[model samples]
Target: MELLQALQDRRSIRKYKDTPVGREAVEHLLEAARLAPSWKNQQCWRFLVVTDAAKREKILAGFGDDNPGKKGIAAAPVTIVVCADPAESGIENGIHYYVADTAMALEHLCLAATEMGLGTCWMGLFNEDLIRKGLGIPPTFRIVGITPLGYPDQDPKPRPRKQLNEIAYFEKWGEN
Candidate 1:
């Protein structure tokens, strides 16, 4: 699929079918993430894929009941725990490159999922300590985010977005 079409078709899916995501499909998404550019090519990002039901339950427990993606987490056949090693990246002008690099990789993962006719929802708000302990993640690694990947069960309309004029400027910040 074309990049723009994939971008436009992508949505934060909260519902999934009782279907399994094949290992090859999972690998394809990972390949896209692996190709994403990182600061100094250090590749700080790491993906922990959870497919077991019991483990998914544990991850869900870390999320609050009010989390919008709770149902998706429970239903998805795969959930990728995105982590980053801050040591692999640097900080410039108070900006952390580790997060930026990881985020770019996550976007690659999500877009690849969309192009493959799969669904994913980027989840972030949760108890990090619980996730780190439950998932046995290293204390040094930062959990950048989690995203449920599966076949979508619902067809959602596109959400609103800011106009280009409102976000982009011709020459200056305020010049729309």
Candidate 2:
């Protein structure tokens, strides 16, 4: 599918089929994320693909009882944890580049999943320490996000978005 089409089609998939996602497809999605640009090319991002039921349970433990993503995590055939090392990225003007870098990579992964007829939901509200401990992730790494991947069980309509004129400007800020 074209990039624009993928972008348009991508959604926060909260429901998934029992179908398993193959290794090649997972790798293909990761490759798309790997090619994403990073701060100074430090490539602070790391991905943990969890297919084991035990490991999935450990990940689920990190999520709160109220997080809507828990259902998707429990249902999807696979889960991916996105991590980033701050030391591997730069900080400027009080902004951490690691977060931005990993976020771009995660978006790439999600879009690739959409193009491949797979589903993903970028979930962030979780206990970092719990996930790190359960997943055996190094203390140096930050759990940026988690996602469930599989064949989508539901097709959700697109959510509302701000119009370009409302969010954009012609040369100067707020100049339409």
Candidate 3:
């Protein structure tokens, strides 16, 4: 698919079918993430692919009761846990680069998933501690986001976006 079409059409899918996703497809998605640009090529991202039913349930438990993505978490064939070693990305001469590098990689993964005819929802409003413990993630690694992946079951309408002029400015901060 063309890049612009993929970017415009990708939605936060909250419903998924029962079909299984192939391992090759999963690898392809990760490969896209791997190619994402990072701070000084630090490439601090790490991904955990959770396919086990019991573990998926555990991850779902981390979501809040009111989270709309709760069902998607439990039903999707794969839940990718995107993590980052913060120290590696931003620690240039003892400075923290924060989450910029990790965020870039995740955006790439999301776009790639969209192009591969798969659905994805980037989940952040969840219990981080529970996820870290449940996934046996190292204490030093930061859990940036979790994306539920599978074949979409719903065709949601696109949400509105602000006009370029409304949010963009020219050379000056307030000048369009």
Candidate 4:
């Protein structure tokens, strides 16, 4: 599939089929993520794939009842937890790069999943501390996000996006 087309077609899949995702496909998606660029090649990102029912249950408990992604997490055949180590990245101009580095890797994984006829929903807004303890992630690492992976049960239309003119500039700010 074309890259931009996959980007356009990607959706936050909330419902999933009961069919399990193959390990090969998961590894392929992770390989795409592994290729993402990072500051000084730190590669601070670490992905935790939760397939065991027991582990999934523990991770699910970390997500609050109000988190909209909870349903998706519960339905997916697998959940990938995105974590990062700040010490592996650096700060520049008062902006920490670890977050950006990790986010890029996650997006790469999501896009790859989209291209593979799979589904993913960026699941943030969870209890970080609880998730860390439940997942047995080191305290030094931050839970950047989580994503459910599986064959989508629902095909959602694309959400609204800011036009290029509104969000991009050719030469100057507010100049197209």
Tell me the TM-score of each prediction against the true structure: 0.98, 0.98, 0.94, 0.97
Q: What's the TM for model 1?
A: 0.98
Q: After TM-score superposition, what is the CA distance of residue 126 in candidate 3 from its true location, in Å? A: 0.8
Instruction: Write the residue-wise lDDT of candidate 2 on 1-176 in tens digits.
Output: 99999999999998989998999999999999999999999999999999999999999999887998799999999999999999999999999999999999999999999999999999999999998999899999999999999999999999899999999999999999
Cα deviation at 152, candidate 4, in Å, is 0.3
Error of 2 at 155 (Å): 0.3
lDDT (tens digit, per residue) of candidate 1 on 1-176? 99999999999999999799999999999999999999999999999999998899889989998998999999989999999999999999999999999999999999999999999998889898899899999999999999999999999999999998888898777897
Model 4 ranges off by over 4 Å:
none
lDDT of each: 0.95, 0.95, 0.89, 0.93
Q: Over the stretch 1-176, how does candidate 3's per-residue lDDT look in tens digits? A: 99999999899999999799999999999998899888889889999999999999879878997999988888899999999988777666765664777777878888999998899998889998898999899999989899999999998999899999989999999789
Q: Could you tell me the C-alpha RMSD of candidate 4 in Å? A: 0.9
Backbone clashes under 3 angstroms, per model: 0, 0, 1, 0
lDDT of 2: 0.95
> lDDT (0-100) at residue 11 of candidate 2?
92
lDDT of 4 at 88: 99
User: After best superposition, candidate 3 residue 46: deviation in angstroms?
Assistant: 0.4
Regions of model 3 farther than 4 Å from truth? 91-98
The candidate, 1 or 4, that scores higher on lDDT is 1
